[model samples]
Target: MRRRVLNGEICKRAACREHDMHWKTLERILTFTEPPGYRLSQPRGSKVDPFLPIIKEILESDKKVHRKQRHTAQRIFERLRDEHGYNCGLTIVADAVQRLRQQNKEVFLPLSHPAGEAQVDFGFADVLLNGELTKVALFVMTLPLSDAICIQGFPRECTESFQEGHVRAFEFFGGVPTRISYDNSKVAVGKIVGNREREVTKEFLRLKSHYLYEDHFCLVRRPNEKGHVERLLDFARRSFLVPIPRVESLEELNEELLRCCTKDLRRRLRGKSVPKQELLNEEQQRFLSIPEEQFEAKRLQTVHANSLSLIRFDRNSYSVPIFQSLQDTASASMRSR
Candidate 1:
């Protein structure tokens, strides 16, 4: 074909069209008198090739060290140059290190959360409160099976916020989840008894008892057990709290969050044929009924009003009735009232 194209008997286009060969290949073929024998290309050597064992050893040892103390690509490159007399660009070392680390990276198994099960968590974001930029804690409750979420903002994350968050979430969801997963937050967990057992806080116990929902606390330092809500917290902050919502109070901010959560029900998530609301409706059928009794969420403490008609609670002072001043009025100490 090359000879035919070159001999002028046939045009290069015609020869290439008939032979189904590329123009560049025909041109190369025409440069040789006959077909060249096949030759194998030799592999090229790399400056870091000799130090691969050392690099692997360093990476292996890194597994036992603190993650922040692990050697970065730049540090590895510097060590190779200084200690092993390596002469290579940082790009090569970085590429090699990244590839090796990818090979050794941890993998996670796919998880499935059942209907009527939920995960709870808290995150913080900046919101405009009364025209001032204020940081607030966001309480998030997510139904992992349906990907439904309920978010509310609070002045702070405390027992009050935690319990109130659950109450609001249950009301918003129209039912209580059969089981709820949580981290070992101090508001919920009084002590870590063992690998799995927990000494739950009194407030948490009261809330759970009122709601009649099973509570599962994740293992200490292992947030991945309830990773669904963990991821949703970031999503909620970025999606719902972005642009720094301007509100008059935490109540107003919570109202806005409720609207956002309600609007999100219309979204059709990936791999789902129906909107989130439909999935939530189906999940609600499996959920426990919301109790008819209203739950009082507060902390109780015994205190005596001082001579100045003041009582201290949670590091702050409040005025009591003057008649109760200088008296050990335990009733006045009930913040729940």
Candidate 2:
């Protein structure tokens, strides 16, 4: 079709009109011009083709063999080459095996955590308390859906501390998460055998039994697996700890931590304006619930020689009358109280 040009001339095609039009006139009409000499280059490299089936076969054989000492890669490679007549190079086989090992590191699956699915991790933070410089390990549990955090300070990271932190976290959040994801800390995972089996610590096993919930440990040397809790620790450090320079006591610091987590950080953002607490409430319904009764908090038991003959509860020890019968009746009364 013929089209009118800027100078009142007519052309049959736009390209013909452009060709006929003055350069300055065309420049005025056209807002932009394309730059010349643009070329697309194909990617160049010796592509290492993946032997997927061979890699899978090797992994399957390794898993089935079950012989600890006999399943070495060198031995497996010899078997594959000599017995199976596989023509793959040793280096190629080794590389493929390594890739498969990495792939099997964390069995990535679509994990849907109910409202109450939470992850716990310990982070180190410095705090000034009552004019004393204190290095405290912060126990942090993050509920992913709500971004709700529960934080407590401990002198050190230990199994007892972790168990205590769990109790305090549940109390602070007013509920417990269905499942708690953990790092392979000595407190949780004792040893990782064959990329699948884990020897968890006794205390953590007891805690899981008492809570009646599943505990998952991240793959060895992979902290990013528990990224949520790690990020939550960063949040707690900035939003809660950094702002508060001084705290009267550990209890006071914990109280402030709870407030910051629930009141400040738990609020919804502008883009996704859904309160964390509300999201957590929904998650709780879908997630596992805490037992009706709280798990009994662990206490250190010490048998001390006392001149007064008494049993200690907190700091104070109550006398058990030296002349009283040391029988079933006395034991029953002691337990009842």
Candidate 3:
């Protein structure tokens, strides 16, 4: 309005009529270069101000209790009225709670995913395998820096399958990541000793020894530490396995998954200039070279045959062949217990 009036495009009366403002307001707008911001003469005080300290203490104490047992706005209002003799409306208490909670909200730093670092996780998807709708476990590995991903389907998520997934992922990536993050799955961690300490399984140790890559296990129930793979697991399921794939075998399904991963490498992500493949190529330069010898993706265990010629493994019983004699393998006088 001021620009039009001052620039002689329109008269002040016409400008006021066009802007639907009173002549005084129009004159004020013309007088000043810009509208001054509003100011309160005096800040308003709330009835709940006297009980704010007690409210803060209650909210602080609520943090130590179970989330389900925490105080709601109504409960806090009742406490303020009954316990502290606070005679304020529920709206005020609720508003105060919301404001305090917002002030006390947790803040997280942005994660920096350096090159040659990856995260591993598992997801599940339903697929038609051999004409049967089967739920398959998907082993997902993602290079966080590159946003490159590799996925393979397995019949079950066992230690053998877990090891095999790493083997195939390393082969697909053309090199092993220098550092890899994983959840505390039994396949890798035999036992968690303490914070950041793990008693890794023998097979897991063997795999790491062969690849020469450092292992990082996430904290108990803390999946966000390796959130890259966790999110990509869902991405793989939705983008690659959507509409429920139909394949004759797990091998066939894996081929399709590999193709999808390769094709996805051509896509340029939001904040990146180059395609994911270029980033992956750069990341591979920092990766550990593949070992000369291959790592076996299986577990070895020795079990004795029982009196009924049965051997027990993984909570299931398997019968020993009738033709094979335990006597020969066992000590001459020892019983086959």
Going through the candidates in order, what is the number of backbone clashes in each?
Answer: 0, 1, 0
The full ranking of all candidates by lDDT, starting with the best, is 3, 1, 2
Off by over 4 Å in 1: 1-65, 71-105, 304-311, 319-337
lDDT of 1 by residue, 1-337 (tens): 6557677999878878888989878877888888776645788777778888888999999999999999999999999999999987999899889889999987878778988999999999998888888999989999998898999988899999899999999999999999999998999999998998999988889999998999998877778899999998999889988788888888888888899999999999999999999999999999999889999879777888898879999889999776545344655566546
Name the lDDT value of residue 318 in candidate 2.
79
C-alpha positional error of residue 325 in candidate 2 after TM-score superposition, expressed in Å = 19
Which residue pairs in candidate 2 have backbone atoms (N, alpha carbon, C) closer than 3 angstroms, thus clashing?
115-283
Estimate the Cα RMSD of every predicted model relative to the unseen true structure.
Answer: 11.0, 13.8, 8.8
For each candidate in the order shown, give its overall lDDT on alpha carbons: 0.89, 0.72, 0.91
Q: 242 in model 2: Cα distance from truth in Å?
A: 1.2
Top lDDT hit: 3
Task: Give the clash count for model 2.
Answer: 1
Model 2 off-target regions past 4 Å?
Answer: 1-114, 299-337
| Higher-scoring candidate on TM-score, 1 or 3 | 3
Evaluate residue 78 in candidate 2 and report its C-alpha lDDT on the 0 to 100 scale: 81
All candidates' TM-scores? 0.68, 0.56, 0.77
lDDT by residue for model 2 over 1-337, one digit each (tens)? 1234444565435645557765555544444344434335666431224345654766776766666743556666787777767776678667766777787775655445556678989998887888788888889888877777888888778766789899888776766677788887877888888564689877777788877777777777777777888887987798777744588787877787777776855578556667776766666675555687667656455665377787776567777656556566789899999
TM-score leader: 3
